[model samples]
Target: MASAENESLDHVPLFPLNAAVLPGGRIPLQLFEPRYLDMLAGCLREQRGFVVVLLREGSDVGSQAVFYDIGTYVRIVDFQQLDNGLLGITAEGLWKVAVNRSWRAPDGLNLGDAERLPEEPEDVLPSGHSELAAVLRALLRHPVINKLDLSVDFSSAREVGWRLTELLPLDSQEKQRLLEIQDPLQRLDRLSSLLDAMD
Candidate 1:
């Protein structure tokens, strides 16, 4: 995994999905598309990663797919051949980035010039928001989330906010909005409001 200190705004391959993955989160992907398989191969050989952008328009299979400018830079952490013969990979998000330009490669892969966005500084979780951590702890008890074996710091605002954003049953647009917020506390506040509305 590339450390945040070494991240640069260099050209990278883009993986656009209907869902969003924020920094400090992990996602599973199944690769059968030749373009993505090739992209995966290159990333592994280079010891680098690709950016995951939320699709704004069009299908992920075609060249016409459009995505939001903000995205998460992720590194392949684990992989294996699935029983169905597809390649399954687990990727961990490292940080957020902003796409400056994007185009389709000859092999139909989306490539982009992206700049690394600033990460939220570590902030102590406010005492008033302790229930948010309690809520997340309950959510993590689900077998699906439990299998991820996530490492979380309940006292850190950034980790709590990002993890909650990833775990919540929020729509793609709502998740994208949380991902774009620069302040961890503000993000948590927005999440608190959203949670309230859910009830």
Candidate 2:
């Protein structure tokens, strides 16, 4: 494993595996392919975070995945071994970053340099929007999400943003865009639209 100092900073790797990971969100992945299984072993051993950029071009299946200019740096939070010998793992994103450049490593992991996104406007939900409250409340009660935690926090803009971003079933690309957006209120506004559409 590389030195811990090298493990941190902008040395994050890119998987771009047809998925997006929002800040403060968790993503579960199944490691089966030899290349990716090796990548997983590297990360687990090094405690290095990596990127999960969405697959934007070519056939959704069998296409080479590329790192989005923007991505979430995720740390593996849990892991399991399946009957098939594949590694099952869930990762929670710790930060959002912009990919400066990336390439596939000979060892099979996608390696890349990244720049962390600068802090942005507060992601506070617009207050006193009774319509929003009603819509979200109703949305929270949906059969699909009835068992979820839909609680909101007006006190913390980040909390509100995190809850909205993670609870929604948005497309990976859309979620990626939201992750890189700097204006928090704007992010909330976009999230509001997503929630409204769900209702």
Candidate 3:
């Protein structure tokens, strides 16, 4: 376990994306830009994690983009050279972090001073939440989703919330709000409510 003090002191390399990755969720990135390729090499070499923040404004082509302060720190788990020679990287989100400040490097890569948020404590799943798990299982039945190998324990409250958040087609802002939530049970309840409204 990492102390809160140590966690807050850790700085992270930033990669702003139009997508959101909740804690426990995994996302695949296509790396082509020179800055990102270099960042990927360094992360792979050092076995370090990087933060993925949702792009609030600007484009991925340049470092001028504005991003949400809430982000996820992810570790690369799979990497491959794509047919077009670009780097195809798969990273699993491990920590939810709050970006205290951000700046662009001379090389065009973005970096952030971040503080890791406290993880939600373990809690038992509430009753009548089987529908949530069922929905996720149905989604897994899809060929595309099944191929991703998203291993999850539906019985776990935290996994259930995070995985559902990942599988849902909610917009980036909605997903960011869920990622910033610190309570797993409340997250689940909110998700359930959202799904109910959707229905």
Candidate 4:
């Protein structure tokens, strides 16, 4: 007989938020609110992953609160209880996903299921992508007050572009668009255009 727990996984748990969690990346969260504190507790108790659903449209409540469906399943990689009673933590990406449903919990926090997508290729990032990366590298090279601490994670020009884009403190909406673009090549193209426009 199939276990109900196993079956529930088929319909992944949704922990929707007004944010974009990139694949091949880490999302640090402050679990302060009760609803989210419960959400994290549930994850820990069940050992089941939850989806970080992105909110796009509607009022900040009920089904209307969520918009963009794509997201990544995140696992708590590290955590600590702060003096402010908030859980300071980092969630490491496990899978890219598309939302299958959206709804509101009794507490009025957001939640939704996400269709996990496979990862992009491990090949070289396109030339255009590399160009943007060069720009970013130069920018990072110049130290500044409160500079972003970054790490180089790409092997080729193409990956370098996308990886750099991920590292930057870009807007959540823009980052969500990048995660939704499954094609690595096309993603690099889009990133190239976005970075060029910024210049």
Instruction: State TM-scores per candidate.
Output: 0.94, 0.75, 0.90, 0.74
Q: Rank the candidates by lDDT, best first.
A: 1, 3, 2, 4
RMSD in order of candidates? 1.5, 4.2, 2.7, 4.9
Specify the poorest-scoring 10-residue window by lDDT in model 1: 1-10
Compared with the true structure, what per-residue lDDT tens digits does model 3 show for residues 121-168?
Answer: 887777778888888899889887786788888888888888888779
Error of 1 at 65 (Å): 1.6
lDDT for predicted candidate 3 compared with the true structure = 0.82
Each model's lDDT comes to 0.89, 0.64, 0.82, 0.62
Candidate 3 clashing pairs, residues 3+ apart or interchain: none
Q: What is candidate 1's TM-score against the reference?
A: 0.94
Q: Candidate 1 on 98-191: residue-level lDDT in tens?
A: 9999988998999999988886898999998998999999998999788777888999999999999888998878888998999999998999
Clashes of each: 0, 0, 0, 5
Q: How far is candidate 1 from the true structure (C-alpha RMSD, Å)?
A: 1.5
Better of 1 and 2 by TM-score: 1
lDDT of 3 at 47: 63
Best by lDDT: 1
Model 1 misses residue 127 by how many Å?
Answer: 1.5
lDDT for 28 (candidate 2): 70
lDDT of 4 at 88: 79
Worst 10 residues of 2 by lDDT: 58-67
